[model samples]
Target: MRPTLLAVSHGTSDATGASAIAELVALVDRALPDVDVQAAFVDVQQPDAADAVPAIEGPVVIVPLLLSSGFHVHHDLHGIAAKKTDAVVADPLGPDPRLADVLAERLAAVPGDGQPAASTSPVILAVAGSRDPRSLTDAEGMAHLLEQRLGRPIELAYLAARKPDLRTTLTAHPDAPIATYLLARGFFFDLATRLAPGRALTLPLLDNGPVPSALVDLIVDRYEAAEANVI
Candidate 1:
């Protein structure tokens, strides 16, 4: 029998954020009809990993819908996987070039500020920062990927717990646009928008409904990779 793909995320209380996550899971379910897909969260939502995993009868793969291998991935999800012999955990869904493509697409979709040239409008890749160095590294990797795609430099700013906070970054580049490095709408995304008001161009991670094909593909890839080791 095919193993179930347990797509876990750092849950949010924001209704829009919740809806976005559900849409993402639905997209993954559609992509892999043969394999069962389930959604769980690490916090702030019901049916967390622990509650969701026990119900599955056969092998399971826990794919974190997170951008980095931070506390939730290492401790929360790992703790859940440890209790199940047939389960394996997959890495977070970011630091991928495809995500950069999504960022670029979001940037392009936003109405231009009537700037003479794209090069004139700088970008700040705003993320919910982590104290973990590895997490920071992953965010930096994403910034680099986005920079390559946009053919310009992108500054990395955090919503919390890191240097170069959003306000500071915005102050530094008054006219720059903020490309949110977030998966869905939440407190951080809201804060980013408030920080830059008119200049912040937000991208809905999974919440845009009808989930992006690229994101679905990435989630499936992670599930398949973990499933391969489910023995």
Candidate 2:
């Protein structure tokens, strides 16, 4: 039997957040119709990896729907995979050049009055900050890739737990747009928007609508990488 793809996320209570994750999983399922794709969470939701892993009958791949390698990836998902012999954990979805393409697309497509032009105004990459050094490094790596793709400098800011908060970044630039480094819409993105208000143009990640093609490809790539070790 083909390995079952277990897509896990840091769950959220927000309806929009839940739906966005579901949609992304659905896209993965649709892309590979023969494969079984399941959704689980690390927290704040049901059917976490601990519960979901035991129920699966064959080889499994746990792909974290996270932007960076944080506690959830290092501790939670790794802990769950350690208990199961047939399960393999995939890397988090960030620090990839394809994601930089996604961020550039989002920045270019931002509509309305305050949208910043790629050639002129500065862009800030805003992420849900982490205390983990790996997570911070991953975010910076992504920022570097995005900067290369856009042919401009991209500043890094955090919504929490890091230096140069969104407000400070905004205050300094005063006219730059914030390219959200989030996987979905939730409290973090909400707080980011509120911080800058009208002054910053915030772009959505995967929530509130359809999943992007680049993200879908990235998900498939991670799953394939893990599946290679299934035997």
Candidate no. 1 TM-score: 0.94
Best-matching candidate per TM-score: 1
CA RMSD of each candidate after superposition: 1.6, 1.9
What digit string (tens of lDDT, one per residue) describes model 1 on residues 173-211? 887777888899888888877777777475666545567
Q: How does model 2 score by TM-score? A: 0.93
Q: Cα lDDT for residue 2, model 1?
A: 88
RMSD of 2: 1.9
Q: What is the C-alpha lDDT of each candidate?
A: 0.85, 0.85
Kindly report which residue stretches of model 1 are placed more than 4 angstroms away from their true locations once superposed.
207-209
Pairs with backbone N, CA or C atoms under 3 Å apart (clashes), candidate 2: none
- Angstrom error at residue 43, model 2: 1.3
Ten-residue stretch with the least lDDT total in model 2: 112-121
TM-score of each: 0.94, 0.93
Tell me which residue pairs clash in candidate 1. 20-207
